[model samples]
Target: MIKVLIADDQELIRQSLQIVLNSRQDMTVTDVAADGQEVIRCVRKNVPDVILMDVRMPKMDGVQCTKIIKESYPQIKIIILTTFDDDEYVYNALKYGASGYMLKGVSMDELVGAITTVYNGWAMINPDIAAKVLRFFSQMAQADDTISVREKDMEELTRTEWKIIAQVEKGASNKEIAKNLNLSEGTVRNYLSTILNKLDLRDRTQLAIWAVQTNVRKRVET
Candidate 1:
């Protein structure tokens, strides 16, 4: 079964999530936290497979909590659950290694599906949020001249790494890349870390942006 941790400040929200998730045959709520600090504590104790995290929390906040979780427990996937859809929050959450971004108002069915989706090595986002993410990327691409790609770093990637980079450039998350390449998700994540380190990029978001700026994906076509 997929072990999950629900972290939110509101009692109602936590109870609602626990109810929705516990009803699933393939998943269970192992723990719940009222705030970000409690989230870290629960994680250290339960070591859940996935964490449903709220962005705004008293004491530690979800963004910082996510960063710490990703750094310390790299295997644990996190889905950002929030009522706010601000660009900065979304971008920073992605930057910090969130596997999914979903608004809190999503239906219980959708939430269950999203948790399953992330567990199976895929990224999930609310459809409406995805549209916003696309628009954000489009605008970033239009302002391209401002973002620079280092030529020396670009030259350092191997052919396989380049192939992986092309997938990431297409906004394919680690899971999507694994599916497309017929590789394991762990392998995709390893490749992603190598790519990030080699390219001196921060995360998949930066890697995607750099891919567009450098036209790395074009190399695949030609």
Candidate 2:
């Protein structure tokens, strides 16, 4: 089961999210925190597999919390949740190692899928926010050049592993990856763990960013 932590200052939001997430047999909300400082304390105690972080919180904001959490506990996945769509906030959150980002209005099913998707080592961004991110990158590319690691690291992937990586780049869940690859879910998980090790990456955030940076999808197109 995937252990999750809910960190939103709003009591109703936290309780509602907890209720919805608890209904999933494969996931459980292991703890809840009201602020970033509480987030740090709760994480130290439980070490959850995923953290649903709210952007605007007392004491410390989500981006700063994400930086600290990722720096100290690289294994734990973080997904930023907020009502705001500020580009700077989203960019900083991703730069600091958040694996996923979504608006608070996201449906319960999408939220659950995102949690599981990130837990299994993949990155996710809401389609609306993804468009913004793409636009930001487009403008930034015209201003300055950036060098990124090539996805050729993925060429080292086995034929089966390659299939898994392709689906992950598409933001598919492990179950979805299993369906597409005709492999068991456990096999998909194993492939992801191997992929991370082979790439010498920290987690799915690095993998996804590297995929886009290296144009892994385009390489496959060719």
Candidate 3:
């Protein structure tokens, strides 16, 4: 069962989400928080597998909370579920290791699916904002002159590593990567750990962003 934590300042939002999430057999609401501070408190008590975070909150916003939580507990997956569609929020939340970003307007089914997807170690961006994110990343990549340098620096990566990276850029989970590459899941996990260490990336979200920024698959194809 997927353990979930709902963090929203509004009482109705938190209570309503708890109700719906707890009703699902595969999921349970571990706890609910009124704000970012409370979210941190609850997490310290018993860390949940997934967190549905709201962007604007008293004391600390979701973006800052995401950064702190990921820095301290990188294993915990967070999904930014907010009413805001601001680009800075999107960029910062993702940069700070959020695995999923969905607007509050999303259906409960989509939210549940995102939680499962992120728990399994894959990204889930709302389709409404995915194009915007890609465009933003494209611009960010253009301004980043060091991407080529990073590419050259990664020359020691094995062929298997490159294939795994290509699969990651496609948002494949470890299971999918294992099946696609004809490797065991354990082997895939080991490869991922090695790749993260080699590139100094904290998590899969960063790896995927780096892949896009560097057009990694094109290099693999060539």
Candidate 4:
């Protein structure tokens, strides 16, 4: 079973998440925290596979907590769950190695899928925030050194893999990519896995960033 820790300052939100997530057959809510400090303490006591972390909290906040947790325990996947999609928060959370970023308004199914995706070593970002994320990386890619390094790393991808990466750079889901490429969903997933392996990326989030940094999407368009 995938163990999850829900961290939100609001009691109602925390309790609601715990109840909903705990109802899943494949997951269990190991604990809940009202703030970032408590989240760290709980993680140290009983490490969870995934953490649903709210961006705003009483102390430390989710961004700082993510940095500290990822620094100390890189294996644990963290999903930033928040009502706000502030650009700084999104950029900082991703910079700090968060596995996913999702809004609280998402359905329970999406939440579960995000958790599962992260646990399985893939990244998940809400579609609404995807554009901001892409733009964030695009701006950062203006650095010549970073672009050169990412371009060098991207050379290993095959033509088909490049197509897949282009789709990912657009924030297309696996299903959408499969439909667009006229391949089965399993095939798309397999290609994504191979792409991640070839690029030495941890998950799709890194792959997307690399795609933007290396101009894979622009090349595909042109």
TM-scores for all predictions: 0.67, 0.72, 0.73, 0.93
Clashing pairs in 4: none
Candidate 3 whole-model C-alpha lDDT, 0 to 1: 0.83
Q: How close is candidate 1 to the true structure, as a TM-score?
A: 0.67
lDDT of 4 by residue, 1-222 (tens): 999999999999988989998888999999999999999999999999999999889878999999999999999999998765566786778878998989888999999999999999888989877887888878767754252235565677788888999999898889889999999999999999988777778788778887888777778778
For model 3, state the Cα shift of residue 105 in Å.
Answer: 1.5
Model 3 misplaced stretches (Cα beyond 4 Å)? 142-204, 216-222
Model 2 Cα lDDT, one tens digit per residue, 98-125: 9888888999889998998888777778
Question: Candidates 1 and 2: which is better by lDDT?
Answer: 1
Candidate topping lDDT: 4
| Candidate 4 residue-wise lDDT at 207 | 80
Model 4 TM-score relative to the real fold = 0.93
Q: What's the C-alpha lDDT at position 110 in model 4? A: 93
Model 1 misplacement above 4 A: 135-222
Better of 2 and 4 by lDDT: 4
What tens digits encode model 3's per-residue C-alpha lDDT throughout 85-196?
5677867788778998888878899899999989987677776666567666666677753233265558868989989988876666677789999999999988988888
Measured by TM-score, the strongest candidate is: 4
The TM-score measured for candidate 3 stands at: 0.73
| Of candidates 4 and 2, the better by TM-score | 4
